[model samples]
Target: MPSKADADAAPPLPEPLRVPVADSHTHLDMQSGTVEEGLAKAASVGVTTVVQVGCDIRGSRWAAETAAAYEGVWATVALHPNEAPRIVHGDPDGWSRQGARQGGGDAALDDALAEIDRLAALPQVRGVGETGLDYFRTGPEGKEAQEKSFRAHIEMAKRHGKALVIHDRDAHNDVLRILKEEGAPERTVFHCYSGDAEMARICAENGYFMSFAGNVTFKNAQPLRDALAVAPLELVLVETDAPYLTPAPYRGRPNAPYLIPLTLRAMAEVKGVSEDVLATAVSANTARAFGY
Candidate 1:
């Protein structure tokens, strides 16, 4: 027999599903011409907002425009590390910052920072990232240089009081270390969260937000499902990270924020919570974190 306290701790059965959601970390800019079509699909499926991410200067500009052009769209700006080399070796004019200081002293990293500044100044810009360490998939680079770039984004986020959408790959320890050393802003989010249950605890302890993508719904995601129990509802967010992680029923289709409902339904089931309650939390937390 269970103790009364143990029995009491178990939540009653979750309420029946109802209500809509917002995809917290989408790539609407990546979706391109489908902005109108995507918005309509999202509304149809109950996704209220889509937070588009910026991967480079072009994407950054498109992000701002997408936010303004659509009713329920917001934007996040940053230079993802996979594209780091481009900022260095690509078009010289592509560097949006002033005076065009090249390499070392200012580092090509500043080009991204410049885009962040420009975009953040816009009312449509809501958050600061798609940034953070990505060593798992990326090849070797000078750690010092990578650290410099990562720390710069954190400092900028702190300065702007904007939330960060970190992309921590196999570099979990390094990512955690940077977040701590740089004193990550009060509201940090792990986009496409891939860490295990222990990382969930760390996220909870730090008040960090976890934005789950379609991967969480995969058949082999038992660890992710287990981690779900460890995080509070308020700390949980849902995203499509679209054109990727299309979720079960819609897997293989080119994903968009519109498909967020599938992911939301799955997450609600995992948490043993009502879809409405979960949707509300995802939307509210997403808006607050992105200042939408």
Candidate 2:
């Protein structure tokens, strides 16, 4: 797991924005704070909608339940690519699906995908990921399994007609290649987009949404900022990816949806637009991405 700063060191919330926006991606289920507290803080700072994304079966279920209970919240369900190989090697029997016991690595993956599919069908689950290539973490032995799982997620998203929220980390080529091979969903978003200007142009050509996270504000993230500059406003969105990737001046601290204004403002600065205009465009793009 990545190191985080002391929670006590978290920065105070920034000023609320004149125009509200949606956090296109977040992990509310992993936060130390209660969902109510997180949502309240977010609303207080003009973040009116949040799409809570899940990276595993348990988290996916929790995301769906949280979305059901919260009016301004929505859910996206999927297993992380790293989680796929773990399911294949770990206790397959440790999990069950539709009252049936899984017996092996493949069985375990199948069961997990089955459960993810079931969760994706839920009314409040508007997306089918946080699923994609992650070469930064997974090794060669796991890559095959990860690709298999990713392809399955692509199919699931299409079947459900929901957004495909991708988690691409150091494997942009494979992520795009697999999406092309399997054919992407109508609404596909590269969550916490880390690609460069060229990749951003490709995404623009494909009509894929690019959801920028706090990392875009880092001093060394010129490539990401370049991507943001080149990406059209209609295809751009903003997020906290919270409890992680807090924006500059507070990079090590825990992040929350309430802190989104900081990232949004940074994006506006990158695109040379007013915050209000950027915020409005981001919110509309987010709604289109998730169909919310």
Candidate 3:
């Protein structure tokens, strides 16, 4: 986790992108500044839109409300994979307890998911997720709950005819298998896509969108860049995943929507396309994936 000083020290904005694009995933509720300030900063740098992603019920509600209040924003609602285990058992560490609704056990988890279901139906809520498996943080004991929640969220997205945003970490096979078994929504996105070239090919074959983030610019992310190289422009999207995954030269610093240009430029290079061309494709792809 980043320190308070690191979170507060914003990076200098890069040159604006010539073609405007959307930051397909972000967490404004976790960032330092007000929503208005973040949007304004992003708009000035050619990031004209963003998707406010929620990790739990409280964040989901905040996301929906913020999206409703702001034209430039859309919301995706879900309980994070780690949050599922916590809701089912308990959050002894309280990592995700901020503004979180109280309760524990099966019934409490169901109630929380029900609220997410209701939020998914909202006009401003364009997606259902940030949900999926996270084997890294969650131990074997929590796998069942995570998969259950993931399947439920998948159904919710399909029922509501919205995009399904997946957060897969060290659980790629399971994520892919579950998506295959559950029959993914028409518009499914791998948020901050962490797969390799082979996985990128699979996603293309299945018509899933791959959303790349600042981490793609890291020195050790050649595999991610390789994935980008093979990913079709139409199936590619870009995001900040703000307050995390800050791009190169600014790694360990706070990320924001305004830094999207840095990542987009990096992606354009990997794809061997002009920034404008890639941005145009991503802008169009985002609207299609999230339905505006």
Candidate models: Cα lDDT each: 0.76, 0.90, 0.93
Q: Model 3 Cα displacement at 165 (Å)?
A: 0.3
| Model 3 per-residue lDDT tens digits across residues 106-187 | 7667877888999999999999999999999999999998999999999999999999999999999999999999999999
Model 1 stretches with alpha carbons more than 4 Å out: 1-17, 89-106
| Position 228, candidate 2: lDDT | 97
Which has the higher lDDT value, candidate number 1 or candidate number 2? 2
Residue-level lDDT of model 2, residues 173-196, one tens digit each, is: 999999899999999999999999
Ranked candidates (TM-score, high to low): 3, 2, 1
User: Candidate 3, TM-score vs. the true structure?
Assistant: 0.95
lDDT of 2 at 232: 93
Task: Tell me the deviation in Å of residue 273 in model 2.
Answer: 0.6
**Backbone clashes per model, in order?**
0, 0, 0
**RMSD of every prediction:** 9.6, 2.9, 2.6
Give the per-residue lDDT of model 1 (tens digit) for 1-292.
5566643331222222256667888876556456787777677767767888987667877888878887888888877765554455443555534233454234656756676777876777778888887776666754445566678778878888788889888788999988988898978999999889999999999999999999888998898888887788989999889878778754555677766777788988999987788888887888777776
**Candidate 2 TM-score over all chains jointly:** 0.94
Evaluated against the true structure, the overall lDDT of model 2 is 0.90
